[model samples]
Target: MILVGAVVVLLCWLLGFWLLWHIPAPGEFRRRAGRAPAALAVPESIPLSVSVVIPARNEERNLPCLLQSLAEQTRKPDEVIVVDDHSEDATAAVAARLGARVVRAPDLPSGWMGKPWACWVGANAATGSLLVFLDADTTLSPEGLENLVAEYRVQGGMLSVQPYHVTLRAYEQVAAGLNITLMMGMNVFTPLGDRLAPSGAFGPCVVCSRADYFATGGHKAVRSAILEDSFLGRVFA
Candidate 1:
């Protein structure tokens, strides 16, 4: 029994690593081609009106950080909408206070999770041509929104960014295993990743044209999905 258990654990580790090795890390190809990683190549003027939609549920404290980040963006969003998902806290008040247009998410319908439902509500209320769906807890760098918009203009597809956790303490290393596992699921790191169909989108930050979003049915189509990111990826695919 002990030998069998050892074999099972070994197989699981091997399988995990195999999956991990197949995904290409960002800028890997650039390095291989003897080129440096590309800088944020945003143009001087972006024609499309951009909307930053945040989905929040009891995130009053975290909202300020993300909202502040948005305020400091090099290219500011034309509009910011916060979908307050039935929070017990003052999420809506805080978002409105920060100049975000707050939309109170309706009572969750059957088979819908709070996050996706909130996202759907915000998307519908958004008036911009370009839509950026962000989680309440995500705080972007000064140029993050600009860089993302630039990528969307160039790539012309659903774009998702996985959150990069910045850890200064050794204790945060405890998340290393989970983080690596999550990255494996993204399937974009392997040397030949571009040749293969992408497996899924990350949940925290996603961008796309409003037309494509509605055409693919957006979060409304994945109302019941727990892994809304992966489902949204397929819908866009």
Candidate 2:
């Protein structure tokens, strides 16, 4: 029994040591990113029109907060459109009341999911040079839209950002598990980072030029995908 216990302890110690040595600390990722390329840099004076497109289904309660945040933005959207995905709730009414143009998402096609279809419809309707696709539940900070546009002006490509989630109640704290799972799924902190092609993108918030969106085929390219964000990211890559 003593010999068997000794062997188990040795194995566990080795496994722990292996993981400790290989997993990356999140901050280390910034160090790994080298200088930006000259080709990606754009002049500061360039002007681009921005549109905020939100796809919603049964989000009447949450939609107002987002629109309110949008209204409070230091850098306003040229236009804000909400795509109502056949919600039983009063989503369209609430959106129009809050000063957002409401558009009805057409019926789900044979090959597309609700979100991607709504997004596709919204994109086609948008008149801006830049498109910001944001989830209905998300609320931006005052400088949020400005910062996004500024960053896009510098980098000039599809940009994805993970929103910091806040839990208002103890019960909501259980959502930390999903947060942990997402960090682990990123593969950035693991040995698999080099071997696997990264498809990890924050689907809840994304910004890109309308031209790049169309060039990559946009959401329509990944219409039938179960995880359309991953597929769309892969397509853009």
Candidate 3:
């Protein structure tokens, strides 16, 4: 019985691998060709004004790292807006010290989730052509912003990135496998990712044109959703 179970598991793994391999690769699946800010040859004619929005609640510890990283971006955003979502900690102070424009998130209204409401507030305050929504815990590489802009110009739609897990604790390392499985289960790497169904979006980082974002009603459309990021992706699709 043990041997039979082992064989079944191995076969299942193989089948899963085969399915993943056979799926059509989306445009966003391309390798990181531009590794530095200078490497991204954005056309001078195309005016790309990016506004980065971060929604934080009691994220004082994590907010600093993200803000510092953003400061180091090769292709710097025109502005960074950090929405303080009623944080009990020094999240607002940290963001302000880092030179980010801090905005207070209004009291959560009925039928609105915290994160989405904060994001919506930030989006409304943003004045850039492109909006880059990033979580407080996310740290970007110096070239990350440049690469994102390059990719967006090529893909011409919403772009969501599933960050590479950098884990220190053993439990976190173990959880990484589950995270990958969840992403794969949603068909994130397949062509279906471009559609509404059987698709996924990573909430940690998302970039899209301001026009497209508002066209889909932004987070306001998914105000009550528990999985606002995933639902927002579907709305964009």
Q: Against the true structure, whose lDDT is highest?
A: 1
The TM-score, computed over Cα atoms with residue i paired to residue i, of candidate 2 is 0.81
Candidate 1 ranges beyond 4 A from true positions: 1-18, 21-46, 168-172
Q: How far is candidate 3 from the true structure (C-alpha RMSD, Å)?
A: 4.3
Worst 10 residues of 1 by lDDT: 35-44
Better of 1 and 2 by lDDT: 1
- Estimate, for each residue in 1-237, the C-alpha lDDT of model 3 and write its tens digit: 999999999998986674364343433244332334333334446788999999999999998899999989999989999999999989998899989999999899999999999999999999999999999889999999998888777655788887878988877899777776767766544444444254557789999989888988999999999988888877876
What is residue 110's positional error in candidate 3, in angstroms? Answer: 0.9
TM accuracy, model 3: 0.86
Q: List the residue pairs that clash in candidate 3.
A: none
How high is the lDDT of residue 7 in model 1? 100
Provide the TM-score for each candidate, comma-separated. 0.82, 0.81, 0.86
Q: Report the candidate with higher lDDT, 2 versus 3.
A: 3
Per-residue lDDT tens digits for candidate 2, residues 1-237, read 999999999997775454333543323332344424333344555678999999999999999999999999999999999999999999999999999999999899998988899999999999998999999999999999998887666556677667778889999988876765555565444555656555566788889989999998999998988777767777776
Model 1 has how many clashing residue pairs?
A: 6
TM-score head-to-head 1 vs 3, winner: 3
